[model samples]
Target: MVVARTRTTCVLGALLGGALLVSGCGDDSSDDAFSGQKADDIAAKAVAATDKASSVHMKGTAKVKGASTVGLDIRVDDQGNCTGTISGDGARAQLLRSKGGDVLIKGDRAFWTNSARAGGGDAKQGEQLAGKLAGKWVTAPADGPDAAFCDKKRFLASMDQDKTERQGMKRGTETEVDGEDALTLEKEQEGNRISMHVATEGEPYILKAATAGSEDSTMTFDDYGEKVKVQPPSQDEIVDPADTQA
Candidate 1:
């Protein structure tokens, strides 16, 4: 069963910053131009790249701390929904991808809603693991075509309006993410500093998000030219729909 084998063998179609400020006042126009490109523009590129990876099929492996600890094979469709199965220890559970932006896990019998209210309902062992995978969706670039970057766009827009460099600047470094070379973006703003490793893997862009302040999140994309696939989930093992919430 895929669910029982928890030593990290959940194979098959599986998945998948910073800054500070000080002193009184300052403004280096050159520095601002170099680094402070409108968050909208930069985010647009990211979102555009992401929007291109929609309605595609992909297979990979994933792992999350304090979570289910299994490998997965997941899939997503053009409508922005996902589904799949996870395997570990010969135990397998069905994973459902919802159009409403949440996941329902079978076998362990748990469901998670994409509520921004901080805490949802009961967290299952599998759900906890899935949380590590699903939670990253919230970080999608705002100002994109889908309005998916709702939270991020709002935050950056707020900063832009205040003219407050709450997020600090970065002298980025060239680094590798998910085996692809990318420019690691770093920033410290509004009491939150985060470093995001951006890269491309075929159609879906990969955004590995990590914060100096809290938990880390990862998002994979599958670009279909017009629409993009964001935060895709499992593909292979299909948990019984009846076992999940409707």
Candidate 2:
């Protein structure tokens, strides 16, 4: 499933990382609420509030520069527990990571077949591997590529460090996201226009973010502070990688 894992990583990275690219400043004045605030300050508040959240549910679609579009729905907690589904290029998989660091994944036939083929297996071999692996939860190391999907702490750390400085950020009209009051912050980098909606009611968390242009991506964040519920697969339902290798 290396191909699947890599696609997931790339999509998640772009979805999460590209959303926080607000910087510089704008002088445009909107009569709407939040007109008194600077775009950079508002963006900073959203970042800080999101960073303090103990857990969150993220759902989004991202298309990296040269990759196919990927869709993900995941809930993750600071304690490292996560449960999610990822889909791309006609393949899909369900993933779970426990607080104790064990990772498990169950992929559909297309996911396994694509993985096998990506790993250099012939068409027949790919079909055979897919038959054995499809619909079965398989163990992956805590530090493996799949783990990247489950690593909330790591994701946050990367976010903290990816603060890029760019220009042309502006504040837009106030709006509601999922019924919560929000203010929009927008900026254009290179040829892509990025827009973000920061909650105005409570913690100022980013409620939605989107980029349009060279690489299209959109992500929404919600269920802040909710606990991540991750249940490990029963022994009978798990397919050990060692056995598969053997």
**Where does model 1 exceed 4 Å of error?**
1-40, 55-74, 79-81, 85-93, 97-105, 109-171, 189-192, 200-206, 216-246
lDDT of 1 at 114: 20
| Tens-digit per-residue lDDT, 1-246, candidate 2 | 000112333223322222222233454565465557777777777777777899988888876545577777889888878999888768888889888477788888877877776666788876887788889998877776557667766554444453554235788878988998888777777787778888878688878877788777777889999989877877899988568763
- Residue-wise lDDT of candidate 1 within 1-246, one digit each (tens)? 001111211111121111111101122232322255433334334434543444433333333344433334455554545555554433454444455344444432222222211133344534554444342222121123222112222212322232232234343565676466554456654344455444523432434444343323232332333333344445543333233333
| TM-scores of the models, in the order given | 0.38, 0.82
CA lDDT, every model vs. true structure: 0.35, 0.69
Scored against the true structure, residue 81 in model 2 reaches a CA lDDT of 89
After superposing all C-alphas onto the true structure, candidate 1 shows an RMSD in angstroms of: 12.6
Best by lDDT: 2
